[model samples]
Target: METLSLLADGFSVALTPSNLFLAVVGCILGTVIGALPGLGPSNGVAILIPLAFSLGLDATAALVLMTAVYYGAMYGGRISSILLNIPGDEPALMTTLDGYPMAKAGRASDALVLSGVASFVGAFLATIGLILLAPMLARIAFLFGPAEYFALYLLAFSTLGGIASNNQAKAAIAACIGLGISMIGLDNNTGIARLTMGELHLMDGVDFLVAIVGLFAVTEVFVFIESHGKNSALGVKLGKITIPVKDILRCKWTMLRSTFIGFIAGVLPGAGASLGSFMAYSAEKSLVRDNSQFGKGDVRGVAAPEAGNNAAAGGALVPMLTLGVPGSGTTAVLLALLMTLNITPGPTLFTDRPDVVWGLIASLLIANVVLLLLNVPMVRLFVHILSVPPWVLLPGVTMISFVGIFSLSGSTFDLLLMIGFGAMGFFLRKLDVPTVPIILGILLGNNMEDSLRRAMVISGGEWTYLFSSGIAIGLWVAAVLGFVAPMFLRGKIRKPQAITD
Candidate 1:
């Protein structure tokens, strides 16, 4: 009841004409990008942040718009997965295991509608989870001190590198690179440049937008070009978009189970949409009546993965908003936007700025509705995005990144730096090292360092300060377990669909 009252208050702000309009626009744009190969939610959200700032809207409005885009992209990713056998992003990969087969069997409309409805159900439930759980989580975080916070951040870094990638060594290296990059600017403790190399531009450290633009948007362009541009997607004739009432009834349990599974995965420190969706698909495959049809046009396959991934997307926001720890790459970008806007997200965020927190929650619900409406009836139009030639799409994306990054700093040097990171990103992506943990490293690196310094100062440089408190010791144990447990879980989990094209 208390949550309901607060949510009603949130609706008052979210329903303002301007805010509603932004939500609609974000959904449309997100769908367009999600339909396109190589442009996932993270890329879509990252590139749009700079433009969102230029819109002159207040921070709440901008966050609402960006988060709406995130949800829309999750909803839209299924379009290409079902129609073209191409996942729009990594999280959508599991959809293709059965979605494309359903399309091939002349059930394209069914596949799209089922996935669309599942996405809605998942996001709706996850938002409720967010409403109930975020405050509790934030309250718990209030007890953390500098030492506890450092250990917590270390746990985040460890889990990200340990689990998000197949090879922990590569993930660690990527994180180290990002941490090293974060140290390029002057050391606040000593008032001396550490790795600036005397370049004035390096004194400020790399802008998060520049890194995100280069790593996701620019690297994606290069990857698309390497694949010899876009090819034609398989066409499946559309029937009525509506699912039969019988089918909906049958899927009730699948949707509910996947929602819970996905939400739990999303709330974990490093598990994200991709993992959630994959786990849900695996569970559905095991429990469904027709296990024989698990990957061969199984509607449950489409329904479960779509629901789980969308739910996970919402769940991921819990840590980002309440604890200032992003569980995935997309949320990492959102965190960067908050920092850029001088909005520090933590326990105090909800208490200090209830409007932003509640308003965002309300807007996310509205965006889910918008995405469902857009996807169900107009999916045929979205599928047409596959027909767009790569030459046209790639250039537009590249131009957008270049223009946005330059606008942020007004420096050609930043452009060069972006290109440099683009090259590094391209090469690193070739190794499948997972660039997300690197961004996480960069985002949390300074804070982690500051916490360490603060704890040491309080302890008179005694190294024992690192383990001064029970919470701090617990966090250290968790960090070590985060790194060690993955080795045991690696091959035990079902492999996700790795389909790209």
Candidate 2:
């Protein structure tokens, strides 16, 4: 009953005339970004963070607009993957395996419609899961002590490094680098600068938004430049938006299973949308008899991963909202936005700021509906977004990143930092190492350190306090398994890779 009243209040806030307009515009812009190769939701939100501030929008309004874009981009990413054989991000990679083949077989329109419907189903169902589970989960979080939080953050990092990256050693190195970066600027405890390297601007830590935009948006621009003048064309004509009833019936089980898998995966720390999609694809292949058709344009093949990835996106929100710990790269960016807005997420957020929490949730429900309506009828409009030249789009994105960061602090140093990180990001991508863990490390590293220090203080510097509880012990065990299992799997796959290379 209380939840209902809060939701009603949220609707009142979200349905305001201006907020509604922003939501619509955000959805459209998000779709455009998602349809373009190399511009995922993280980059999309980071690039546009400046626009929200420039317009003088409040935190709630800005978050609603950004969240709308986040989901909208997830919907739009499928178009390029299906038509051009290019994934907008890692999660959409599975979509290309079957989606492109379907498009090549002259069913581009059908693939588009089916993917839209599947994405809507996954998102809607995941929202339902969030609505029901978030409050309960938040309540459970209230029981955690600093010791437990330290353990939880450790679990998050270990799991993230394990599941999000294929190479554990590389992932660990990336995480250490991010942690080192986070340690820059003045130390909170001693009030002394640690790693400024004698630069005056190094007194303040690197802005999260600047680092995100530089690492994702700026690096992406460099990559697109390398592909400049290449023949990356959308060849097939979009014939009609029609999803046959029989196909829906056939994939209904796949969709349902993928939703559960995605939600569970999203709830876990370090596990992300790509892992969810990959696991769902593998699960569907194992369950279906004619698995031989998976990479050759199987409809179920398309549905499972699409459903899983969208659901995972929603699932990633769980930890961010309830625990104040992000579960993925995109959520880490959202966490930065929340902090910038003076909104502190955690168990108390639900009680103290019911309006923001419920309003965002309600907006997500509306955004999914808006995305579905926009995607089906305006499919061609989204496809046309791909025709934009990189020269025009890259500069526009760079401008947005520059303006947003400057609006917050008006610092020239921030701009230089953005460019430096952008160059680093480009090289990181070239090395096949995941950037998500780096973002996760930067966002959570300080919190984890604080929690660990508090836990030790409470325990009188006793090391056994770290493993005092059954829950903490269990979490530690899980973290170890998460890190080790990937190494074993990678070793098995490495032998076959050597032959191919």
Q: What C-alpha lDDT, on a 0 to 100 scale, does residue 7 get in candidate 2?
A: 82
Cα lDDT, all candidates: 0.86, 0.82
TM-score of each: 0.97, 0.94
Clash counts for the predictions, in order: 0, 2
Error of 2 at 320 (Å): 1.0
Model 2 agreement with the true structure over 1-501: per-residue lDDT tens digits: 887888888888888888788888888988887888778888888778766767778988998999999888888888888888878666777888889889999888878888888888888999889988899989989988888888887777887778677677888888887778888888776788988999888788877777888898888778878778253553447776676677778888898888888878777877767767777777888998889999899999888888988998899899999998888887888887888788989999999998899889988888889999998778888888777766777778878778878887789989988899899998988897778777777777777877888889889999999889877888789889988877777743221010100
Instruction: Give candidate 2's TM-score.
Output: 0.94
Residue 155, candidate 2: Cα error in Å is 1.6
Per residue, candidate 1 scores C-alpha lDDT tens digits across 187-305 of 87888888888899889888878888889999988887798785545443577667656666778889989999999889887888998898899988888766998889877888899
Q: After superposition, how far is residue 421 of candidate 2 from its true place, in Å?
A: 0.6
Best by lDDT: 1
Q: Runs in model 2 with CA error above 4 Å?
A: 229-231, 234-236, 491-501
